[model samples]
Target: MRLDELPLLTVLIVLPLVGAAVVWALPRAARARARTVAVTVSLLELVVAVAAAGAFDTGDAGTHQLLETHPWIPAIGASYAVGVDGVALLLVLLAVVLTPLVLLAADRHQGGTGDRLQHYLALVLVLEAFMVAVFAARDVFLFYVLFEAMLVPVYFLIGAFGGPLGRWAAVKFLVFSLAGGLIMLVAVIALYLQGPGGPQGFLTDNLTGLDLPVVGERLMFLAFFLAFAIKAPMWPVHTWLPDAAQNATAGTSTLLVGVLDKVGTFGMLTLCLPLFPDASRWAAPVIIALAVVSVLYGALLAIGQQDLMRLIAYTSISHFGFIVLGIFAFTSVGVQGSALYMVNHGLSTGALFLVAGFLVARRGSQRIADFGGLQKVTPVLAGTFLVAGLSALSLPGLSTFVSEFLVLVGTFARSRPAAVVAVVGVVLAALYVLITYQRLFTGPVRDELATTRDLSVREVWVVAPLIALMVVFGFYPAPMIDLVREPSLVTLDQVGVPDVPGGTVVDRAADGGTDDGDDEGSTR
Candidate 1:
């Protein structure tokens, strides 16, 4: 078969699942071998993902590449379909790339060994497969199935392997997730019922073109948006995240916040806007308002957090607020920025969580007040923490700055008041990060902390890629920006909104001339 004809996506989704099965089948006594196998398999999956990325046609950013389809559940008009556009590909890469790092970062104390070691590894691999499938699914039904199903391994990873309150946190996470899933299920069924009634009816393209009653469309939009917002963990519905993050292992928290949580905003981008353009626009103001509130509320909460894990979780809430804000603004820069923010947030937040996990492991506590003058004993750890913290604060030299800047500028063009209010979150971010750093890493060295060691070679390897990517993308974000441009335009077109001139003008002017570069100056 030709390269494009190969079932690359299916392989990408199945490989880890198969690996999980193999890990599970191993003798329980072979926990060491199982860890090796799991890590090796994750590495192999990352290689496959990179090969797929290499083959992706970046020049044609609007179309899904390497499309694969087969008949599955014809009774429900659902087919086994998968493909990747720039947006999907980026997310897939994120999932694949993070899985291995998370596995490698796993230590015995964090529930990486024992009789359940194989089970933990298997569940992580299974979660990886579902995450890839969720991002790659071209069929709406398939997306929803994988969307809810993705929760299974995560539930186990947390409830079975997490901290003292793991089971309770897991239950809370599941309850919130299931409530959202139920709401989305109603909307999905209603949408399918309203369709022309065939296999094609379940496809995203076909569903996008459907003409439904205004009230029906709005209701469906709410169903999907509510689910996504909760997943995004927007304020009010966001309480579960702090508990979940605090209780889960750092590696688990990394995947939960970095990759899985993204599914929520991803749904908003891929499902809500395209499938219900009028409803998206109709609901933009309210969503933007909520997003702004999340930005401030999350930041304020982060500053007050006593637990390091919970603090990082709160920061994600703030970051996600910016992402949702950009998505709803309906401007080219805003949407593209949100897309890029998804990628950047994964890297930065994943690093912070992992580092925080290391600190907790060393100090035997997650409380910020437990450590003082850590820089005197473990300079490397303190330095790594500083880098990750600065990145979270959107330091200008980091990858986050570019995306966050775009989101703010884009929102400013569409709604100055919203953008202005969102900017306060930035100041709050700096306060939280610096204060946490000061509380833990600064001050006189304590005799107890003097024995604490710095990062190991393995730990360094885990964080090295994330730090490198942040710096590289910070200076040169064009490649990612180019990939996101066409998708943003397509979304703007669906929403029937022209590109806001202020965004375009500011972007162009910042680049030092009127030339529009590879995007051709068109926002749909």
Candidate 2:
């Protein structure tokens, strides 16, 4: 719990900001130099993050570690508090890991390298800083600042380097994000005004500890949930996502869909439940229904997509459905499943986007119909896409399988009908992913793409680890399971849900779970 021990979180957030500054300060002629600097900084940040994870005590994750809290705006009772339980730590690690890979992927494609590359790298680094902050911030206001601020860089990313419709996509994305952010901001203000201790104002930990009135609680909860839903891009609000992804460059699309989008669901699991337990319980069934609908709906849309990147975008909607499903299941298994799925989905889908980007860069087309017999033209590219595709489908021996299975199992314990409907999502995922593979990678070789090469050395290096980790974690998820077990249990308790005994961690009939933070002596 020493400051040095907690330096990981600090460095994870700061390094990216520093990188952004460096990128921005670079000479106009040093585009390549700027890229190099951005990559180096991100890689260093990733290393520090990994080292911190190596030192983390998984068994004692219920309680915060490397805890740092200090007065920021003391007048309003806001503080610069930051720490990580198991779930937060894991996500922090995942965000760090993906960033360098994103930089590498960006470099390999060299898509928008002239005047725009520096800005792109800077924006990405800034986004990374916000991402780490979101995972680490212990104060409600700090989290909200980071949450909403995360969108700015992405807005520039899509608008600057995306497809022919990039400008439109960026504008749409900003409008939706602004609308959600403003609503959430109003809710935050309300919470502060009415919070316990009178004028002491709001802090996440303190807010969760307060006993607000039921009606007030539900409204606050809905405010937060609506914002997260839009970010999660659930069903009705999900249209923006596909357009943004389709318009973005391969690397930007990969990072946007893979990592940034998880912020919505992450906020739900970490902030909403802890701060508004009763409201969450009351809204559980409705949220679960929406989750199932997102699953089926996202999948159907993905199945019918003619655009590869857009298809990947729709798949995220479906994947997020599982995350939402897990959150509402009110079980430790479900919660942990959702958290792990968040990380797993990032790796698998990020790789898929990377591969798709590679294809689009080579073929200069986004349409699936434009791709034909890619396996014949470039076997390595085909194989990489296959691995990413299988992982997306939650195939056995891939990272997503464990999490997706846990979500369904936990959900079934509480809502059999919802779980049954969700199962169809799994089947649909297989169809969409496999059909995409068949149509794009397995058809007759196209004359235009015959000379297209397989993944380059840097490309392989960037994605190889992701694919390997997916398989490694898929078959042996015990380490990850242990990482979030107690934190998730605490989260479930915060949501006023009972824990399931034995294999599962949710009980539908009772609100009984342990979040006493009593196990302080457990080893990593």
Candidate 3:
């Protein structure tokens, strides 16, 4: 079959489902093989994702590629519609790449046979399936279903394999997600009613360009953005993240905070902006303000964190703020940087969690004070942690630095003051990372951890790919840049915002083509 003719996306989605079943069905004698099964399945998923990349055309990255639409629920205008643009494609790839590493790095001997090892691995496989589908879903309702559906595997991952407060964290996460989902459901139904009614009315293409009442438009945008913001876990709605991250296992946190959390900003760029352009523009200033606040707030909190897991979680909040700021900046550079930052943050932060997990596993503690002078005992672990930490701070020449720099440059063009304030976040980032590293790896050697083993070969494998990717992308980011450019332009075009010369944002509706304005939203 031709590349386009092949049901590549369905295969991508179903492969994991099959893998989940296979792993779960393993006999008791063979239950230990669950990790093997999961590893193989995730690697296969990565291969399929790479294949999709090979088949994709970067020059036409703006348009959805590899579409597979089929009627699902005729009554509600829902369909099994899915596709990927450059933005979605990159995120899908990130999900795939990270899954294998997580499975490989998972502590197999923790609970032994009774730990339901099969179940944990199976849930991860299931989460992978949803991760791909949610990013690929072109229909609004399908996207919503996948959006809310993801909470299932993640909920279990935290609850089943987490710490003392695991179940409570899971419940809180569910409550928050369901609350947002319910609100989005109302907006989703209202959205379909406002569209051209038909079997595929809920498709994003069909729903775009709707001329609704001003109040209605903003409300829908608010509902959708609220859902995304909560998922993205921005400022006010971000409380659940630290709790969830703290309770979950390292691998779980890696996927939860690193991969799943990105769905929020992705929704903002793809769904909110394209479908509700005017509302997005109208809400820009307030969103940018919140984004800046999240950046500062998360960083400040990170610097003061005693628990390593919570610190990482807080750092992600700050990173996500940068992402939202970039998306709302309404510049090609900003959006592109935001898009790329999503991938970079996943790599850097995910590795941080994994390495921290390695340390926690050895020392049996997640507290910063629990570790000290480990650089001499476990030089390799110390080194890997440092690399991940430096990446967190967006050290020059790292992959994160490239993305973070782009976001700043792009935002500076539109909102210098906001960008200026965000720079304070950059300074705070350095402090938090350095302080954490100093406490964990420097000073007098801890007598208790004197014999702590360095990273084993398997542990090395888990972080090697992540570290290598960061280094490769750090020096050469052209491929990522190409992937994000077209979609950035597409989002800009859909929002009806003209790129003004000299960093000004020209509102076609507001200025009537004559007046120039900075991102007025940044000020508010």
Candidate 4:
């Protein structure tokens, strides 16, 4: 069969589910083979995602591609619909890419329930399928279902397999998520009723640009945005994350914070802006303020955290703040930058969480004060940790720097004061990263951990790809930036926001130059 003819996205979603079922079906005697099976399945899923990317029509990547729709509920205008635009495709790829590495990082000791490795691995695979599905969903109902359903595997991953306080953390995570999901559900039903009633009424394409009532539009927008914000875990609603991170396993935290939380931001761009254009523009100022607060609040809290896991989790809140800020900024560069930031953040933060998990496992503690001077003893572990940390702080040569620079410049072009205020969070970011690094890795060798071992070959394999991608993208972000450009323009067009001459649309009048990079003298 031709690549285009193949149901690649469905397969991408289903393959892991099949893998999960296979994992669960493993006999008691065959439990030991579970890890190998799970890893192999996740790798296959990644291969399929790459194939989909190859077949993707980059020339017109802004529109949904490889779409599949099967009438799921004809009565309410819902369907089993899925597809990916450039940004959605990238996020889907992120989910598949992280699954196997996280699985490989899971050690035998992490098998909390007796012979529960298979169940745990199956849960991971199930979560992977949902992650891909949620990002790829085109039907709002489908998206909402997957959004709430994702909690199942995650709940188990945290509550059953996590650390000492895992149960409490799991309950907290559930409460916050359920509350958000419930609000989004109401918004979804209302949207369906207000939309063209048919088999596919809930499809985003069918609903976009509807002439929603002035008050209703804003209300629904709030309802939908509330769910996303909580999921994004921004500012006031972000309290659940650190606790979950503290109790859950490294792989769980990596996927949960790194990829899952992005659903909220992704929903904003895909649903909020396009579906309620006027309301989005109206609410932009208020949302920007909240996003900036999340940025500073998260970074400040991260600095003060004593637990390494909780600290890393808190940093995600701040990073997400920048993403929401860029999206709400409503400029082409801002939207594009936020999209790229999502992908890059997944890479850097996933690596950081995994490495930190490894360190805690080896040292048998999550407290920052537990050990010091690890660099002299374990150069490799220390080195990888440092690279991940540097990426977190947006060091000039890393992937994050490029995206962050775009966000700030884009925001400045539209909202200079907010941009200026957000920059303080950037300065604070440096302090948390440096202080944590200094306290944990640098001082005189601690007597207790003087003989500590370095990263295992498997651990090195887990981190290498993420670090290499960060370095490569740092130097050449063109490809990544290109992926988001067409979609960014479409988003801005929806919001009726023109790229003010300086950044997004390019200030050819000011510079006396055209967008054609080589034409220094050419102008309109």
For candidate 1, the per-residue lDDT at 320 reads 98
lDDT by residue (262-372, candidate 2, tens digit) is 889988988788888777877887888899999999999999999998999999999999999998888777888998999999999999998888888887788999988
Q: Each model's C-alpha lDDT?
A: 0.89, 0.83, 0.90, 0.89
lDDT for model 1, please. Answer: 0.89
Q: Across residues 1-524, which tens digit of lDDT does each residue of candidate 4 receive?
A: 77877899999989999999999999888888898999999999999999999888887878889889999988888899988898999999889989999988888546444367788899999999999999999999999999999999999999989998999999999999999999888889888888897888999989998889989998999999999999998989999999999999999999999899999999999999999887887788888899999999999999999999999999999999999999988777889889999999999999999999889988999999997999899889889988998999899999999889989988888787889999998999899998998888898988989988899899999999999999999999887777789999888777665566545343322221224554332221
Candidate 2 whole-model C-alpha lDDT, 0 to 1: 0.83
In model 1, state the lDDT of residue 351: 95
- lDDT accuracy of residue 408 in candidate 2: 92
Can you list the residue pairs that collide in candidate 1? none
Off by over 4 Å in 3: 108-115, 501-524
In order, what is each prediction's RMSD in angstroms? 4.5, 4.1, 2.8, 4.7
User: For residues 249-313, what per-residue lDDT tens digits would candidate 3 score against the true structure?
Assistant: 99899999889999999999999998998888888888888999999999999999999999999
Report clash pairs, candidate 2: 498-512, 500-505, 500-506
Per-residue lDDT tens digits for candidate 1, residues 1-524, read 66667788989999999999999888756767887899999999998888888888888876888898788888888988889889889999999989988888888867656766778888999999999999999998999999899889999999999998999999999999999999999999999999876865688877886788999999999999999988988987999999999999998999999999999999999899888877787788888889999999999999999999999999999999999999988788999999999999999999999999999999889999888999988998899899999999999999999999999989998788899999999999999999999999999988888889999999999999999999999999999988899999888887655677745433321221223444554333
